[model samples]
Target: MSMKNRHVLGEAVRHLILIILALYTLAPLLFLFVNAFKSNNEIIASPVALPEHWTLQYIKTAMEAINFGKALGLTFIITFFSILLLVIVSSFAAWAMVRSKTILSNIVFLCFTAAMLVPFQSLMYPLLSVFEKMGLKNVQGLILMYGGFGLSMSVFLYHGFIKSVPASLEEAAVLDGANLFQMFFKVVFPLLKGTTVTVIVLNGMWIWNDYLLPFLVIGNKTGSKTLTLELYFAKLTSGQYGNPWELIFPAVFVTIIPIIILYIFLQKYIVAGVSEGAVKM
Candidate 1:
């Protein structure tokens, strides 16, 4: 074979492998989706094929059971505030740790890194008591808790990323007699845009999807559950295996759609951030 023809064949082989892997990964989702449309008997009979008689009855029943609107609102609120606080608090704390360079700064940085490894599961009771004592049981409390918990990871990422930023930009702002706050907002922080976008996207997704912490902290109170919490209920039931999968698929799709939209819109930023982390390291 000619060299060019040989290269084309190699590319084709790689493409075929990727296609197979994609289908393999997607198979379960496809299976669930098809079975969702099938009746219980039909689903058992044809687990992998399209339903012969597609119906909206299962979807309607699921929506009624799930209480779609209420569930969605609850999820949105939890995700929004949690992400907001996680981003703001983590960013500020990270900026201070990396930029200040004091003895306390080193200690703060270490504390966060240490906190990340501290196994949050072990601290569940203590954390709950602390929040309860502080009267943080509501959404505000939940946001603050997410902020604190997410801080270590966010700061760790931000600290490393900010360290790679050139300090000369801040020095130039200072030369013009800009105050520290002004200098940070206008000059230093803005320069960290790439890193900031990266942190936001990363933390946003994490906070949006986390279930355990919120479950413990927020409880199963109405109007406070997150999408993750909603899905948890859908995943299993007490002594029940007959629940239709289609009932939960719509809610699952709702949970994921935001992340999909975000990635589509900011894919370049996300990719650049991931690349920069390795290069900086």
Candidate 2:
């Protein structure tokens, strides 16, 4: 084939592959959305078929059953505060460690790096034991747990990105009579906008969608349930012997909408932050 023709054919093939991948990734989401509008029998009868009659009946039922407003509020509070704590603590630690440039700092940074590899499963029981002993099986404790579990990766990201940042900017701020807190917060933190958003989006989604951590900390608690836990109990109370696909689908769809909106808005920052952070490391 002519060179131009060959290039055109390759481009066509790449586009075809991408289209297929896109459909594959979106298929489950599409299914979930469709099923949310369907009755249990309809879903069971034709899982892949379009709902014969689209309705908001199931969605409204789910919202009421799951106590959607309260669960959503609790979930938002936990996710928001957890990400806030993670950003503040991790960024400060990363900045101090990077600037210290001491042997001890190096050791600490390496420890954080190694922590990213440690399986949460191994630490889960020990952490629960410690928290229980301290009477921390509550929202505050859950936020603290998120900060700890999320710390390693957030620090790792900030560390890399901070190294790429020119130290002269901070030095100039110091010379301009900026104190330690002012310099770090006003100057350093502002520049980390992309990374901060990236960290928030990454960890925020996890905390919002997470069932395991919340379940462990506050299992089936009446007033403190996150969205995931609400969905779980909603499903449990929905049926005794069989799965409640109708409620499950609608509840899940409702729960995920916030995170999906978040991702849509901040996705560009995620890519930019990861790329910028990776530039130096």
Candidate 3:
């Protein structure tokens, strides 16, 4: 076939495939949104039809059941500080590995690489024992644990980014009598805003939506259930009698809202950051 004809055929096939996939993905979300408001009878009678009476009762019940505000607040507390520690500590660690020129630096970077492959499940018992000994089976302990786990990946990302960052900025800062602290915080650190955003977006979602780790570590102590764990329990409890749409749907939406908002604002950086890492690997 002619080049033009082949290209036209390929374009037509791509469009057809994309349209089918879009429907496959979007139809379920549309179903969930519409069905969350529908009566059980409505869902049973006509799965695709619009809800006869849209309801906030499910949302209200869900929020109340999970204590949405508290879950959100707790999630923010853990994710914010965890990401902060991950960014600051990991960026500098990565920079030193790249620029400092030492066997120790190489060893440290290698250790981080190894650490990244250590699955969370394998470390659970040891972590639980340490927390138990230290009496940190609470939200704070969870945050600390997340920071440790997140550091390896965060450092890996920072390593990629700092490779491309010019070193002269740090050297010039040194010429200007800037100390290590000043050169890092004021100069090199500012340049890492993209990678930092990337880390924040990735780790923010991971820590925020996590359930198993928090549940295993903290075990639903009244004052400190993170959002996902709470949402899980809410869904479990709400399962009887048509799932109490008043609560279940709202919980589902609440669990997802922050991530959606974060992604909306930072999608460009996220895409570039993800693609950069993928291409490097």
Candidate 4:
């Protein structure tokens, strides 16, 4: 074949591969969305086909059953506060470690880096016991736990990105009469906007969709449950005999909508922040 024809054929093959991967990734989500409008019988009978009669009945029922509004509000509060705490604490720690460049700082940074490899399951029971004894096994406690668990990765990212940032800017701010907080917040933190958004997007999705932490901390109680917890109990109360596909599909569909919308809007930042952070490191 001619070189031009070979190039064209290569492009065609790449496009075909991309299309297949896209469809593969999207297929399950598409199935869930379609089944949200379907009855259990309809879903079981024809899982792949479009619903014979699309209806909002299942969606409404799922919402009412799960106390969707309250759960959504609670989830938003937890995720927002958790991300805020992670960004503030992690950024401060990362910045200090990077600037200090001391033996102790290096050790601490290594500790944080090592922490990312430790599985939560290994510490889960002990953490719960400690928090329970401290009377922190509630919404407030959940937020704190999220901050602690999310800290290592956040610090790692911020550390890399902060290395890329010139220390002269902070020194200039200090020389101009800005205090510690002002120098860090105004001069340093603002420059970290990209990484901050990336941190929020990454941790927000995890916190929003997480079931285990909330289940262990909050116990699936009606009054103080996150969306994921609500969905769990919703399934349990739905029926004893078998899976409740109708309720399950719609509940999961609604629960994920917020995070999906968030990812859609902030999707661009994930790659940019990760690349910029890793650039210096």
Candidate 5:
């Protein structure tokens, strides 16, 4: 074969592999969607088969049982505030660490970076203990917990991006009489948009899909239960031997809708931010 033919063959093979992988990843979602419209008997009989009739009955049942509206709203509130606080606090923390010459600042920054290695499961019990003692097992409390747990990586990303930022811009802001908060917010923060988008989407997805931490801190019984926690309890009454595919699948579908929409909208930002941050790092 000629060189051009070999290159075309390689490109074709690559596209074929990509298409296969995409189908592999999306298969479970497709299965869930198909089964969401199926009755329990139909789902059990032909798990991968398309439904005989698309019906909203299971979805309606799941939504009503789980109080889908309330859980979704609570989840949105927690994820939004958690990302907002994480970006704001992590940005200032990272910027200060970059600009400050103090040994303490270095130590604190090192501690935060080191914290990324600590598994959430290891600290789960003690963290819940502290929260329970202080009566912090609520939506507000969960947001704060997310901020703390999310800080390590957020600071790490911000720190790397901040290092690439020229100090001259901040100095110019100071010359214009910008105070610490104003300098950071107006001058420094705006420049960190790429890293900020990276942080928000990264942390937003984690906080939104989180189950263990929220389940531990705020029990599934609470009015503040998140969507994942709601899903957990949705199966409680299904008995020991059997699964409630009808209710469960529809609830699962409903639960993921918001995050799906969010990703579709902000996927461009995610790509751009990741590329920008990677370059700076």
Candidate 6:
């Protein structure tokens, strides 16, 4: 075959593969959306078919039953504060460990790195015990828990990115009478935009979607429930006979909208952050 023909054939193959992958990813979501408008009987009867009668009542009922607005609010609060705490604490710790050369600092950095390998299941009971003793079961408490769990990986990412930053700017800031707080926050933190965005997006998605941790910490709690936990309870409340597919589908869709919106807006930054983190020191 001619070289030109071979190249064209290869490109076609690649495009075909990409299209297949895209469809594979989108198929379930498409199914979910279609089923959201369907009644439970219709969904069971024709799982993949178009809805016999499109309606918004199921969506409305799901929203009300799940208390989706409240769950969304709680989720936003947890995700926002978790990311806030993770960024602040991880960035500072990364900066300090990178800049300061001491035995204790080295040990601390090593510990953080090591902690990343420790499975959460191993620590679940102990973490619960400690948090209970510390009274950290509410939204504020969950924020702290998320922060602690999120810190290690975040610090690892930040630590690598921080090393790529030149020391001269911070030195200049210090020479110009900037104190430690100003030097780190004003001079250093702003430069970490790429990594910070990466950390926030990564942790925000996890905390928002996470079910098990919140279930354990805030199970059946009247006023405090993350979106995922709310969905879990909704599923249970439906039971086997009274299958509430209509309710489940819309609730799932509503729960995911925020993260989808966030990703759409910050997608460029997320790409930039991952690229920078991957290639830079």
lDDT of candidate model 4 versus the reference: 0.93
Q: Over 4 Å off in model 3, which ranges?
A: 44-48, 239-246, 277-281
- Return the TM-score for candidate 1, rounded to 2 decimals: 0.82
TM-score-best of 3 and 6: 6
Could you tally the backbone clashes for each prediction? 0, 0, 6, 0, 0, 0
Q: Rank candidates by lDDT, best first.
A: 4, 2, 6, 5, 3, 1
TM-score of 3: 0.89
Predicted candidate 4 versus true structure: per-residue lDDT over 127-216, tens digit per residue: 999999999999999999999999999999999999988989988998899999999999999999889989999999999999999999
| lDDT tens readout by residue for model 1, 13-125 | 99999999999987876766676566666656767778887777765555555566676676567667776676667767777777788999999888988998988778888
Error of 3 at 255 (Å): 1.4
Tens-place lDDT digits, model 6, residues 1-281: 99999999999999999999999998988998899888888988998999988889888888877888898888898888889999999999989998887899889988988999999999999889988998886777778889999999888888888888899999999899999999999989999998898898889889988988898888889978888988888888876324678779888988888998887787778877876665664
* Weakest lDDT window of 10 consecutive positions for candidate 1: 238-247
- Cα RMSD to native, each candidate? 3.2, 1.5, 2.4, 1.5, 2.2, 2.0
Candidate that beats the other on TM-score, 1 or 6, i.e. the better one: 6
Models 1 onward score TM values of 0.82, 0.97, 0.89, 0.97, 0.93, 0.93
lDDT of residue 198 for candidate 3: 88
Deviation from native of the Cα of residue 269 in model 3, angstroms: 0.9
> Residue 227 error for model 4, in Å?
0.9
- Give residue 91's error in model 2 in angstroms: 1.0
Scanning candidate 4 in windows of ten residues, the lowest lDDT window is: 234-243
